[model samples]
Target chain A: MSHIPLEEGVPGIRSLVMYRPDTGKPLYELAQVLLRDESPLSPAERELIATYVSHKNTCKFCASSHAAAARYLFDQESGVVDLVLDDYQSAPISDKLKALLTIAGRVQEDARTVSDEDVALARSFGANDRDIHDTVLIAATFCMFNRYVDGLATLTPTEDAAYAQMGERMGTIGYVLPQKPA
Target chain B: MSHIPLESHLPGITGLLEYRQDSAKPIRELTQLLLRGESTLTEAERELIATLVSSRNQCRFCTTAHKSAADILLGESETCEMVINDFESAPVGEKMKSLLAIAAHVQKNGKNVTEGDVIRARNCGATDREIHDTVLIAALFCLYNKYVDGMASFTPTDPAFYKKLGERITTVGYNRLPGGYDQLKTQS
Candidate 1:
């Protein structure tokens, strides 16, 4: 059961969103700009960043949700998302992303830990300032989302079926949820 | 100087926000809405929530800045400090202390906040709206703390800067943060 009496049938951040919609619109709008918009990072890469942060935060709902989205988008090897989450350093990904993930991991634990050397490594791997900026933003934003969902103890579906449906919707339709206020 | 090439010399999000104020409009707008906008929670309470989270995150810049804001809004320069030192023994009402406890759990780990916690807050006369906003404030500060610390932004060491800024925000509100929103409007 959730801390507050949220509407039934909604899960994760959606339940939280439905509970207090005043905050959700802006949060969703920020998500659209960060994840769904045009940027140097692909949607999958962005989702990967979000997943990594969520995983580090130990928010199972957020990790599984974004991982499903990335898996749908990547569409390559099975359990690749799991492999990346287990260890992105050894996961099959670009060096730029690997370096960026290092920074994201530092951000997940404590922002101050990400040092000048981290930025240099990412830069050397050809991640420009924008890439670096977005990676940090994605990581930072997911921490908020993860906490919001878990702090309230929102419903997290156990079945992969829900995640598959959600992943397909997010992958095809993108992050803009209908502002049809609850 | 900042870890990154931010325009302002002051450390923390101020410099980062100044570095690319365009990208900061969403953040600024969000801040204005939550902290300054009308709601069940007072701006003082909201700022306290922000301050507590920053303190837990150990983000030097945000803790200083927001504690100043909460102090100014509450018209007590020492209340925020007392709360930070010990929220339970602080002079705040039981309800606020409970809310702060919930917020602290959010800072450490959200899942740790339990059903019993919510009941305790409600038992203290907090409304659903108040509880709802507290959760948002806690989560929002996590985003903010990370943003400031992730980039190694500059944090002002001077106490006067925060005192003045805090006083100004308590009066003029966040939308009119000097050239911040004004400059962004014209540029965009």
Candidate 2:
């Protein structure tokens, strides 16, 4: 059973959102702008940023779902998302992304730890203001999402393939709230 | 020295938001809902949650601002200070302390929160909604603290300034605060 009386097996933030739609609406809107909508960072890259932070936080549901979205968005290779999460330093992603991920990693642990050198590094790699700003927000925001899901002890499917299926739906429908279990 | 070239010297997240109102509007709206919107948790308690998290994150600007707001709603200054320094010894009831303990754990690490914490809170008379609200408050401030300090925004120096601002907050309210932080310069 969840911390609250949620349904049997709604995973991650999904169940929590159903519990409180008032908070959920803004959280979804934030995600829509941060991950779904377009900007300097491609939607795939944004999802990857979220995926990386969720992975660092060790939230399985978030990491898996976002990796699937990233894989769906970027067709160059299937394993690329996993590869980058494991070792973004060596992964084939652009230097700009690597730099942004470095900052994201800091935000995951301690926001105060992000230094002038980190900002300079991203700039050196050609990440402009908006790119860096969105990356930090995505990483920081996922911390909240990851905690909200895990804090409440929401149920998440363990099978990695389940995330792929959910990811397909998310890719098609975006971050709309699903009906609560009856 | 922000990641973005935000111009305001105004303290805390305001400077960062001043750079981009498009991003700021929804965040502002969310805070309005969470902090000021009608809830089982009084606005004071919500602000207390926010203040406690900021103190843990060591974000001076937010700690000062929200603590003042908490004080205003609570109508007592020493209790607010005691809660921050040591809630166990503070005059607050056990239920509020239990909720604060959960919030503290959340500020430290989300994974640390366990079923036992909820059980303890329930034993102390916290409802499901109260427990849920505490978790959200802790988690949300984790986001806000980063938004404030992650970009190296200014921190106001005078304690009196925060007290005055706190007194005004009840009347003006969070929703009434400027949406476009870029225009903050002119208002200041």
The best candidate in terms of TM-score: 2
Q: What are the per-residue Cα lDDT tens digits for candidate 2 across B57-118?
A: 88888889989988889888887788889888888888888888899888876777888888
Q: What is the DockQ of each candidate?
A: 0.72, 0.70
Local lDDT at A91 for model 2: 94
lDDT of 2 by residue, A92-159 (tens): 88988998999999988888888889999999988888887888888888888887777777787889
Instruction: Identify the runs in model 2 with alpha carbons over 4 angstroms from their true place.
Output: B176-187
lDDT of 1 by residue, B1-188 (tens): 34457655345676666655545666777778888898878889899889989998999888998988898788786788988888888888899999999999998888989888888999999987787778878988999899988987777788987886677667876563665534433331
- Per-residue alpha-carbon lDDT of candidate 1 for residues A1-182, written as tens digits (9 for 90 to 100): 88887878788888776665666777777877888887899988999999999998999898888988888998876466888888888988889999999999999999889899999999999998778888887898898999988988889999998998888887888776544343
Look at candidate 1 and tell me the lDDT of residue B180: 53
Q: What is the C-alpha lDDT of each candidate?
A: 0.83, 0.81
> What TM-score does chain A of each model score against the native chain A?
0.95, 0.95
Instruction: Report the lDDT of model 1 for residue B21.
Output: 55
TM-score of each: 0.93, 0.94
